[model samples]
Target: MPVELVALIGLLVVFATTTLLDVNMGAVAFVAAFVVGSLVAGVPVERVISDGFPAELFLTLVGVTYLFAIARDNGTITWLTSAGVRLVRGRLVLVPWVMFVVTGLLAMAGAPLVAVIAVLAPVALEFARRYDINPLLMGLMVVNGGAAGGLAPSSVLGSLSNAVVERNGLSIDPGLLFAGSAVFNVLLGAVGFVLFGGSRLAGVRTSAREPAVVRTSGPGATTAPAVAGSRLNGHRLATLAGLVVLAVGALAFEVNIGVLAMTVAVALSIASPAAGRRAVPQVAWPTVLLVCGTLTYVELLQSLGTLEYLGRGVAAVGVPIVAALIICGIGALGSAFASTIGMLGALIPLAVPLLGDSTLSATALITALAISSLVVDASPLSSTGALVVANSPESQRDRVFRQLLAWGFSLIVVAPVTTCLVFVLPGA
Candidate 1:
């Protein structure tokens, strides 16, 4: 049997084990990568660790979760939730849109997609619980918002995608990519709002509040909210400042989100070790493991030429329109599991041969590619999606995971077709 086929089978088996036996998908994937990389592919475990392991994402998951864990324990999150509600005047329906727009603007302004999602997801999920809004809807809005805004010309994705297009010698406007993604996600957000109970949010309102003061009496302990809408004490104030620093550093300076988060989290921990130690248990280790393992295995597939093998098939199609759809399909499917920026770099160039022929509209095809690739960032496996799952309240995590899994895979089918019909077919 082909090694690629075996690796593919191993992936399916990993998912099957997760669904059936309730095992951590990350552990199963790690074992699969080991078995396949070592025995079948003749690659060393050292190489997989160095080459396939998503060290950056690991830092991100641990840092963001740890930071937010502190925020949750200290009542800072609760305070922010109330502040957000007040900002929106307690009209529940507006809350998700606020999250969507804020993240969108941040992404459009050039924060990395992961950075935007990481900072906002925890706060957004709090709004979900506080207002009884659908957590899936709230989470996905943030994901989509970040993805949509990330397509702008100044953004990382836009820069990378345009560079690839220039290298591939395709004549396409960068603005079209941003416009297409923005429109698609806005429509998608509206659909999610409705489907995930957005209509119920109308006229719903809650009072604006301040952080209730809470204090620690001894080591490894904390008091509950002492007052509602009261002045935040020193610890919560310091934590909030750390969050501000995280947002500013990540967005304005383009610092590594994970590293910066770790720095802030560690600093806060040092300032108040006992209270900070309390947050260590709250880090989302399982989610960290799940995302990192999945990406490592995906990296193995990439190294083994599996994606290139599929890319070759895309170039061989006789019909331009059909080939265009296939490219979008592959982009969505691949981006769902891997990095969005990575997918843009990997998949868009595959259309070089077809686009080289000048038989397809570069605007429609490239826009379709961009939008299709990014719309799936809501998938549980993708960075934006995983960030959401990690930051979510414990009770909502499982439900968000299932919903995103279904939505992500479903988009693999739906987004490609929709983009093709809306963009490609019109031109064809």
Candidate 2:
């Protein structure tokens, strides 16, 4: 069999072992990458490690989790959640939407999805733990909300897609693309809100600064004092300042978030050695291993030409509608395990010839493909979902991570088809 075919089979085996054994998917994927690269693909070990490993992503996970871990220990997260509650007047149902709108606007204003999630996920997930709100809902809200504005003219994702289209001499309305993405995410957020226990929070109310959260459901649903919601002190103030620095530096300066975050975390650690010690153990190391391993497999596949090979095969069928759906399918599945922007960059070019068929709408097909690619960022294999899993309360980490994976995989199965039916076929 061809190496590309072997690589695809290796991926299926990784997923099967991970799912059936209930083991870490990333661990399985990481091991699979090495096996396929060294034996089946006839590649060397060093190249596998160097080429396939997601080094920058690994840094982003470690730095973001470490900084947030320190903040959680020092009570900054609690204070921030308290302040957030005050803004919403104790109406917990609005909390997720507030997160949705805030993150959406930030993306529209030009913050990358990763940057927005890095800065906001800790506080948001902490709120989920304290108030009995579903972490899945809040985490999804944070991710989808940030992604909602992904195609705005000023946004990096939007600029990249538009540039690709322009380079290919294809024309699409940039503004319409932005609007379509925003609406799709907003609807997804609403669905998650209704499905994942958001309705249970409607009748619950409390003071924003009461220092306690009320549990509205389950066996012992009752008011409980907030964990680590202590009065502000010097260290907490310093941590807040570091968060501000992270936000400003990440969004405005476009610094490498991993480097900037690590810098901030190290500074905070040096300033308070005790807090640093406590925070180190709280970093989401398991999620880190998982993401690195999974992405390594993604890299392995990309390097082996498996993804493009699949795309080329589907397009070769020569049926425009079927070809369009297949492209969207590839985009969704590929984006779930890799970067959405990267998927867009790679797959859009493959669809250009299909657009040249004269019967198809370039804008609709591209827009469908764009939305299909992005809607799966909540996958654990992707950075957004990994951040959510990494930042969640340790006790609930496993449960929330499971929910995110299920949700993400479902999107992988359903998003492409749905987006095609909605965005692509309408213009046909």
Candidate 3:
């Protein structure tokens, strides 16, 4: 078989197994890509391995994740969420939109997963209970919104993608990424909102009731009032103030996010050793591992001329509509196992080659990624879903998880399918 055909088959196998068997799709793709590249494509294994680990991207990702962890540990993000909820009066119908904006901003600020979620989750729950709106809906909203954040220019996802694409001799246009990401975010957010329903939001009210708060003694816990006051020294205040500046500078000035994030993480870590150490685990290693593993595989596959051959094979079929749907479906299912970045790594290697003659633009491919990510990252199998369940009241967590699972599938089905038919087909 031709290298392209082999590569396409390998992609299909990975996607199918990920969907059916619940395997780690990234690991599958990594193994498959290397085997095919060496045995069939005649690429050297050493070169493939060396090309896989894009160091600059990984460095920035780790640094930003670490810094975000620090913010989570310090309860900085929690305070932000409280402020956001207060500003909105905890309205059920408005919370999703508010969260979309807030999380987007924080993500742009290079806040880590736990930092953003910790700040937003508690407030969302309070609003859900108060308004009698389904907590599951609110949870999905938060997760989807975070996925949007990851796609933004300031996000680790965006930075990594930009770096990868650039290394492949593609341009890294931050403005284009920003614009494309905004479209993806809006469409996915709207789909999540619609599926969750506005009617479920009826008759919800908020009063002077203060929501229950979780006070852990670890990094994220609030300090005693007097202790907090006493510890508010100039150095500590300067570090906190620097974070605010970092957030604004990155978002408003369009700074190189990786550099900005590393600067913040390193500076803050040096400023307060105890706080930095406490925040490390909140960095979301699973996400990083997923991205790295998939990227490695994709790099190997690219070396084998798989994409070029696959493009010709796909063009031979000449049914753009059906092809688009199949790709989107594969992308979504793969994402369920590997998450968004991983899906992109696995699928794009085949997709780019297969759709070469078709009208599918990089933007359309990105749209598929955005929707797949929104669905799978919010699925019960994903970290976002796990966090939602873990953070919900113990009595309601199980029920909420199941509900969110259903709602998340609705997104997986609707958003990706719709984008395939509407966006990809029209472009093709």
Clashing residue pair totals per candidate (backbone < 3 A): 0, 0, 1
- Who is ahead in TM-score, 1 or 3? 1
Q: What's the lDDT of the predicted structure labeled candidate 3?
A: 0.59
Badly placed stretches (over 4 Å) of model 1 are 210-228
TM of each candidate vs. truth? 0.95, 0.94, 0.57
Tens-place lDDT digits, model 1, residues 269-339: 99978767777877888888888898898889878877667778876788888999899988898899987
- Give stretches of model 2 more than 4 Å off: 210-230
Q: Give lDDT tens digits, candidate 2, residues 1-428.
A: 88888899998999889779989888898889889999888889899999989999999999998888777766677788888888888999899999888888888888888988888888788889878888889999999898898788888899989999898889999988999889999999999999999988897887756353232112223234334345777888999899999999999888989999999999999998866776677778888988899899889999999888888797676678888899998999899888888899898888888888747888888888998888899987898889999988777888888899899989987888887888787766
Q: List the residue pairs that clash in candidate 1.
A: none
Selected candidate, larger TM-score, 2 vs 3: 2
Cα lDDT of candidate 2 equals: 0.85
Model 1's TM-score against the true structure: 0.95
Which scores higher on lDDT, 1 or 3? 1
After TM-score superposition, the amount by which residue 290's alpha carbon in candidate 1 deviates from its true location, in angstroms, is: 1.3
Ranking by lDDT: 2, 1, 3
Indicate the TM-score of model 3. 0.57
Worst 10 residues of 3 by lDDT: 223-232
